[model samples]
Target: MKIAVVAANGKVARKVITEAIKRGHDVTAFGRHKENNTDASKYVIKDILDLKKEDLEGFDVVVDAFGTWASEAMHLHTVTSQHLADLLEHTNTRLLIVGGAGSLYTNKEHTETVASGPDFPHDWLPVANAMADSLNALRKRNDVHWTYLSPAANFVADGEATGKYAFAGEELTLNKNNESTISYADYASAMLDVIENGQHDKERISVYAD
Candidate 1:
């Protein structure tokens, strides 16, 4: 597969690039900052908003790992998602987004999203809520083939791959210890699985530690 990863400098995007290359797929990495090293065959140093559809041509899938915690949180999330959807519309390329866990429901009844829960970090709420709104925007799209992958609640940069994971619908998934978490490596694995298998189309899929 020929894959284009947006925000290539990010932690999760880097992991996804590594995992995708390990699987023998061709990768084109795009980011605001240029890095000295990457396994991606091609690199585009540009802002996601400035990227044109012609720049994204010929890839089998485009992974929108674009995210921001700045004051324009909602604007960045919504604009980037909408831009990608418009760029990929009526094209064969699929849009796979690396989303947040905030949109995942916190309990079994599925009435409350994690962002609506009391424990959701106050500082991170802007970005989280913005991402949830982005998911809502994707859900309403009919022209683009998209998949939004929301990681576990405790998504972090520091854990081993374990090469294992489990899934849930709109709710936060937890392990036997009731911890909702997943390694960045395993999150990359799950995203690649969705990309390669085309299992969850036009929907939000959550992954967490098993």
Candidate 2:
């Protein structure tokens, strides 16, 4: 498969790009920063917001790993989502987004979301809300093929990658130990699985440690 990963400088995205290449997929990385000794066949160093439709033509999928912690720049999450959606509208390529857990439902009835939970970090509200807004926007678009993959509540940057994972629906997923957790590496592997299977299109999926 031919894949393009945006924001490849990020921790999670770097892992995705590397794993895709290991699997012998044609991979191109797009990001603002230059990377040394990257495994991707091509690296396009440009601000993601500046990417035009012409620049992203002819790919199987575009994995959007765009994220930000800056409070004033949080709105860019939705902005970037809209831009990419518009660019990829009705195209052959699918848009796979790296999403947040804050928007995942906490109850079977779907009355509340993880953001409403008391344990959610206050400092994370900006980015969480921004990501939720982008997801909500995607839910309304029928022109683009898209998928939003949300990590567990305890998403770890450098957690152990046991090479195992499990999937869940809209509700926040917890394991037999009653914990919501996933490693960045595991998430990357699961993401590629999703891409390869050609399932879960136009839906939001969750992943947690198995």
Candidate 3:
């Protein structure tokens, strides 16, 4: 499969690209900044909103790994997503968003999101809200085949892949120890699994440690 990753320089996006490349897929990396070193099969230096339809054509899947911690840049999550949807409308390319855990349901009853609960950290609220907004924007679109993959509540970096994970939809998942966590490597593995298997379409799915 031909894959394009937006914000390809990101920590998670880099891992996703690496995983895709390891799977023998043709991968193209898109980033807003110029990088001196990259391992992508192809690279594009352009803002997500600046991308034209021609820029994204021929890819089997487009991963929206675009993310920001700055409060001002948070809006990029939603706006860029809208642009991607418009650009890919009526095309066969699928849009898979690297989503957030904030909006995920904290309970099986779906009464509350992690972001709405008292446990959510106030410092990261802006980014979480932006992710929620991005998901909402994607949910409203009908012309594009979109899937949102939210990470575990305790998603972390540099942990072992183990090539194992548990999947869920909307609701937050917990391990046997009642904790929600997944390493970046395993998260990338799950993303590639979804991409290759085509198991999810027009839905939001999440994963955590098994």
Candidate 4:
């Protein structure tokens, strides 16, 4: 399958791109930076807000991994979500978003996420919450095939690429120790699985260690 990954320069995106290529899928990587070294040669250097429909033509899947948190939290989320929605609507392509863990709940009655709790970094709340809102907006659209993937609650910079994890829909998953965590590699693998198999369409799902 042919896949286009936006924000391909990001750490998480890089992993997805690499794995996609290794799995023998054709990939077109897009990013804002011209200096970044992405293995895919057919790279488009453009801002997400300025991306045109022609730029996204002929792709089986488009992964939206683009994000910014410098501006007002709500504005950033709204702008990013709008761009993604436009691409899906205009180009008529399926979308897979690298989402936040904040939208997942331990159960239906829970109002807060592990990321929004007192233990999470205060500076990260805006971005996390904004991503949750973005996912919410995407779910309301019935014309698009979309999946929002939330990583485990304690996702960190580095961990073993075990490629072993469990998935949960709407409800957050907990391990034997009652913790939610997954390596970036595993997260990327899970995203690709969604892209290839079209699982959990129009819904938000979470991945974590078992």
TM-scores, all candidates, are 0.95, 0.97, 0.97, 0.91
Give candidate 1's error at residue 114 in angstroms.
Answer: 0.7
Please state the error at residue 3 of candidate 3 in Å: 0.4
* Candidate 3 global lDDT: 0.91
Q: Candidate 2, residues 62-86: lDDT per residue as tens digits?
A: 9999999998898899999889999
The clash numbers for all candidates, in the given order, read: 0, 0, 0, 0
Per-candidate Cα lDDT values, in order, are 0.89, 0.90, 0.91, 0.80
RMSD to the hidden true structure, all candidates: 1.4, 1.1, 1.1, 1.9
CA lDDT, candidate 1, residue 127: 89
Candidate 4 local lDDT, 34-140, one digit each (tens):
86567776798887777877787788899888767674546656566567677678444788888888767755687766665677788887877788778778877
Task: Name the 10 consecutive residues with the lowest summed lDDT in model 1.
Answer: 32-41
Kindly list the per-residue Cα lDDT of model 3 for residues 1-210, writing each as its tens digit.
999999889989999999999999999999989881457969989988889999999999999998889877888899989899999998889999999999999877888999999978999889999999999988888899999999999989889889879889899989899999999999999999999988778899999998
Weakest 10 consecutive residues, lDDT, candidate 4? 71-80
Q: Residue by residue across 104-137, what tens digits does model 1's lDDT show?
A: 9877787899888887789988888899889988
Q: lDDT (0-100) at residue 44 of candidate 3?
A: 89
Better of 1 and 2 by TM-score: 2
| Ordered list by lDDT, greatest first | 3, 2, 1, 4
Q: Which numbered prediction scores highest in lDDT against the true structure?
A: 3
Candidate 4 displacement at residue 88 in angstroms: 2.0
